[model samples]
Target: MDTMTYDYTEPVLSPKGQKMRDILADYITVVSHRLPDDVTKKLVELSKIEVDPLQRLIYDTMMENQMLAGKLKRPSCQDTGALQFFIKCGAKFPLLSELNAILKDAVYRATKQAPLRHNAVQTFDEFNTGMNIGDGIPSVFMQIVDDSADIEMYVYMAGGGCTLPGEAKVLMPGEGYEGVVRFVMDRMTSYGINACPPLLVGVGVGTSAETAALNSKLALMRRVDSVSPNKNAAKLEHLLEDGINHIGLGPQGFGGKASVMGVNVINTARHPSAIGVGVSTGCWSHRRGKINFDSDLNYDLPLNEGVEL
Candidate 1:
């Protein structure tokens, strides 16, 4: 391939396009600062049932913290986490690559605009450059679909505080599916405290560790209280949820009626004799943002003209 350079001609953005980017940046900022809707609803419901004074106090503080963080336009947690953007791009869009770049720039910009803590770190050098960029960092997950011009993006703030506790294992062939459940229960009982509770437990079962891990991460991305379409899997989700909730780890690892907020199962086909399982939990403060845009640049959430981004 020969290198070719072209001079700039048309504007990269129209007035509406520029406004759309700013709006998106604002939405990401809001999601970063507030808990997801389902997680917040669970907290309110918990506060009502919470009999223990300390747990009630935590719930009240959490509810209050929501108000203060949004009003102040600051991140609810100091970690701020690595910015993970899940994007579904339209095939007809002319600016696919530009859109990705713009989003990444927005993440870096939001780190400063939201004044999110400097969480992205360079590996091997053991260094903190104070800016969020690192090699292969602030990753984006993208997929292109057919005949769709509208784009949907899910902005997730996957904090290290919650991710650090994730665990996965490969079970022996002799151990059946029961072995899988046992492994999950064991992992949750032992290390569930490491993740902030009440938690959103994402369980992935598949053919290998990497698949399992990825599936578990995907599981956490699902809406809380949404059950799997697969009957058996949905049942397992309900079972694991009840079991974990009974653990009494409660909010912030205290004791209460809501230990693990919800459990989601995302599984794939596994080898006949081998089973790989993974569990990743999101804390009650599941920081995720969403926005949709049409080809005309009309969009949603985290955007209002005159608002800070």
Candidate 2:
């Protein structure tokens, strides 16, 4: 019998490109171990309102887990999740052509350095790729911006538990916004507990299932405390937040005063006959990070504080 050995060498690149890749890899490692600033703050706020002994204990355990993850330099959760990047890049950015390859390489490096769990399994074939890189794994969705020379990215870990409750459907026009609320509430009642409350709920309204699904994910990228800018949408966010909190699923699904950190809604115009709504949830950890980079590779991580990568 022969044993196969794998090579984990970093990919060759221009000096600048190599630097950018290294930075991204380091950033991913940091993200794995640390909760974003907004998420941490929201969790603390929720902890204050919990009156149940068990729910309060759960919140305390969550905070301690975060502290130990950062202090010990390891992932906060066993499910590091499938990496996904949502990016808005300038058409004129220097590394636009190489960005895709750079991102893939960065994940590969992070998988080894962060020791991220192998979460990318090939569909139908049913085998974990082990590298966290498979066909379309470390999913990157990009939009090119005109007249700009910078890039903004949201890095998220869509864990199995959190992604389990995701759903989308098209409602009849006659159902109106009320229908949208009904769909979301149904999902929360049926599956929200599996996501690990207090969850950050993202709601998307659009013309079709795919659009709504994507927008729902984008909504997850927003800060937990953020509200939609559109007046009607903002009101819907508040309404959903109130309704979901009313579920009383509480922290870790034990009963308490609140069940969610916040609810975010993202909406766009839809066809006259149909309204599509999608839901995505982020667990209490809510490991979503935002980073921005200039054409020169100068970078800032707005969601993560005191992180230098």
Candidate 2 all-Cα RMSD: 2.1
What are the candidates' C-alpha RMSDs? 5.8, 2.1
- For model 1, how many clashes? 1
Q: In lDDT terms, how accurate is model 1?
A: 0.77
Model 2 worst lDDT run, 10 consecutive residues: 1-10
lDDT tens digits, residue span 1-309, model 1: 543332223236645555666766677778877777777777788788889899999988888888899899888887788888777888976556477556655666677778878776667666664656555566787889766777878888888868876888888878976787787788778888878788888999998998888788888888887899888889999888888888888889887887877889998999987788988888878887767777876666432223333
Worst 10 residues of 1 by lDDT: 2-11
lDDT of each: 0.77, 0.90
Cα deviation at 57, candidate 2, in Å, is 0.7
Per-model TM values vs. the true structure: 0.87, 0.96
lDDT of 2 by residue, 104-131 (tens): 8999999999989999887876767789
lDDT of 2 at 73: 86
Candidate 2 lDDT score at position 191 = 98
Candidate 2 residues lying further than 4 Å off, grouped into runs, are: 1-11
